[model samples]
Target: MNLATNVRIVLVEPAGALNVGAIARVMKNMGLYQLVLVNPQCDPLGEEARRMAVHGGEVLEGATRFENLPEALEGCQRAIATTARDRHVPLTLETPKQVLPWCLEGSPTALIFGPEYRGLSNQELNYAQRFLGIPSNPEYPSLNLAQAVAVCVYELYQLSQNNLAVPPQTTEAARLEDIEGYYQHLESTLLKIGYLQPHTATARMAKFRRLYNRASLSHDEVALLRGILRQVEWAIKPQAGDAE
Candidate 1:
């Protein structure tokens, strides 16, 4: 569970010094150090943040500031945005428990937190490939910014510590290339059978892609799907007599 260096915590327009400091302390406790601030409203080095940071002062001082969320996440390949409220934006929301595996998959990842008062805007959330929703009492579902980070980071830490043996990295998950090919085959097959209209094809395909992507289908699964598409295509095409 050597995740100490793989994750960057990004705070967007944090207004409370105490929360920033507290988050630094938690980050230190969890053995994580990379912190990025986007348009912070308070001096991250102010007394309140430092006081809470205490032994984690180094993490706070070394934190980088950014003008916006995208700048902070420039080189990051994977990002998970935390939100308590539901939005109509098309995103695959997963619980922290479900997202931990992907976060621990040895890639440079970022965990984004939005403004203290409003949380992440819909536009800001779009930068993330996935959304994480922490399970809290529905009666009072809101979580403090620092607290949300603590929960997500801790779950990640625990998953790392468990160290379950994963399949070999050589057996990579299905790539976007293969996924796209499969999508093309599927849509063409569906259209041939009059299941998808030309006018609605794009929107329907987008939703299907999201569903397939969330499963994180492996190479074998993708192959199996492609085979199914081939069979359907062969069966549906007009034969010589049928066409006449």
Candidate 2:
């Protein structure tokens, strides 16, 4: 099965050249191509990476670089961040087989992996609508970065072979940027209404983000929500000639 070209493999702050190189090779093996690096700590195209990549030199060389996760995820409609660590946020950690298939259902999807030492921080994980955790022995559950990427990529490749059907969409799915915009607007409006305070906004917003993400909000849905926030802002504004 031919993998979807829109599926991007994003490595966040990856520090190991060998791991990056091996990830490139496996992506090629699984018929995946797109690779995005976010502020990589190591040289992706250096000799060490090239040596490990072997025949996948093109994939490594052709990788796109971004300064941050949000920028890396621009234009993507669906994203699933892989991690072993848990956070205070209320997010379900699904296995790869369950969530990897979601990437094929949308264009410009992302499978995000965090740095080598620590997994994605809560802030980094927020960029994705879903989270994936590969099942392993409880005693030793963490997998190498390349191994995790390979496992997810292989599942994607296998799913493609079976001719997985894209689920019917009732409405156009919201792009990450669109959702991000809504978040900004929502925060602004909430602050104006005293629903969120400057000191606690970040914590409160994380819960709201999880709520909206779980909804898998469509473009129209986000637009409607933003419109409501706009109206709320307008309602609270002091009109001309109003009492001081």
Candidate 3:
């Protein structure tokens, strides 16, 4: 399979039409066709954007716009997000060379990027399985949104085109929407069992997401886990009244 073809370049809350246009162009140049925009703050198809997209105007016009990251990533099986700065928690930040290859293991994957001014939020970053950070001069670490996308796309193009040895993908991975459903079910089940308090459920679930995402759960694996969660929920269902 042409791995690059399966990769989606997801831009979250992009604020500049020029940036979006440039991103569309670079994606085309790198042979990546999927572009998903999440809650774009600027007009993606303005005159300026068209000028910047140049030969890639079609990519810009054909890009899918989503209301949020989850909506954008619905059908994607694996995703890696770009963060300019390291978070307070110890999230593993890999270089594109290392992480891009792993991304090809899953079908309909994504390489997520945040808006230009401020990078991905903690909440947004949680949606991704892994994180990536490009090495740059520490004195001036920030990279333009489009530039960052370009760099990663270039790396992906080289990796997919060079016929390099890639890890075998035995099973088709489960989609993010399915994984997210499982996560919701798990959280509700855990809360029902008093394993998680309402106030702290978010924090605890983030840990669960990280752990399970690392496993790269296949379709059957996710189904088995969801079934287990469902059984737990059924067992906890009150004989009198049940809360949604």
Candidate 4:
């Protein structure tokens, strides 16, 4: 399978030449390309990186560089940011196994890995629609950036090969944009109905967003719920002193 076309591997400020090269080799073994680097602290074409890449040097050479994360993700519709620590962000999160399918869902997607020393910053992670964390020994759970990328990419490669029961290939599969819109609509409706107070709405909405993202609601379902929210808004507007 041509997994390269579906997903891009993004390295943010990666400082280690060896790790970058290792990642390139692993990506080639897994049949993936499309590498992107954001403000790399080390020269990607440096001797160490190229030495480690060996046969995969082509991937390293063809890599695209960006000064910022958003520029690297311009054509990507879905993005998953890998983190070792939980920041309690508003975005939904999943394990590698849980997120691989969505990553392969026919649109340009990216899996972001942060710097070698510290993982992604909360601000950097904000650009992603979701977070993915690898399950590890809690005693010392943090994974090296290149290792984390290798694991996730390998898992995705394995999933692509299995001729398992595939979900219906319909346009209704709730996309990231659809889910985001629904969350907005739901939160607004809840606020209007006094169920979610302005002060506590953020926390409440986070839980609901997690639920809906896990469920992966269909487009029809999203439309139905949004329509209900619209109706509620319309009904409340008149009572709030709006004529007509």
- Index of the highest-lDDT prediction: 2
Q: Is candidate 1 or candidate 2 better by TM-score?
A: 2
The segments of candidate 3 whose C-alpha lies over 4 angstroms from its true place after superposition are 239-244
With a 3 Å backbone cut-off (N, CA, C), the pairs that clash in candidate 2 are none
Pairs of residues at least 3 apart in sequence or in different chains that clash in candidate 3: none
Q: What order do you get sorting by TM-score, best first?
A: 2, 3, 4, 1
lDDT of 3 by residue, 1-244 (tens): 4754688899999999999989888988988878899999999999988999999998988899999999999888888999977677558889999888876654788889998888999889889999999999999999999999999999988887785537768887889999888888898889889999999998888888889978989999999998888888778777666565
Candidate 4 stretches greater than 4 Å from native: 164-169, 172-244
Q: Alpha-carbon error at 1 in model 3, in Å?
A: 3.0
Q: Candidate 2: TM-score? A: 0.96
- For candidate 2, write residues 8-101 as lDDT tens digits: 9999999999999999999989888889999999999999999999999989999999999999999889889988876766789999888877
- Candidate 3 Cα RMSD (Å): 2.6
Residues 4-30 of candidate 4: C-alpha lDDT, one tens digit per residue: 897899999999999999999999999
Please, what is the TM-score per model? Answer: 0.70, 0.96, 0.94, 0.71
- Between prediction 1 and prediction 3, the one with superior TM-score is 3
lDDT of 1 by residue, 1-244 (tens): 3576778899999999999999999999888999999999998999999999999999999999989876788666567788878766677678988876877776567899998899999767655667899888999999999999999878877877887424335454654456566888998889999999999997787678668756766779889999998888888777778856
Return model 2's CA RMSD, one decimal.
Answer: 1.3
Comparing 1 with 3 on lDDT, the higher-scoring candidate is 3
Best by TM-score: 2
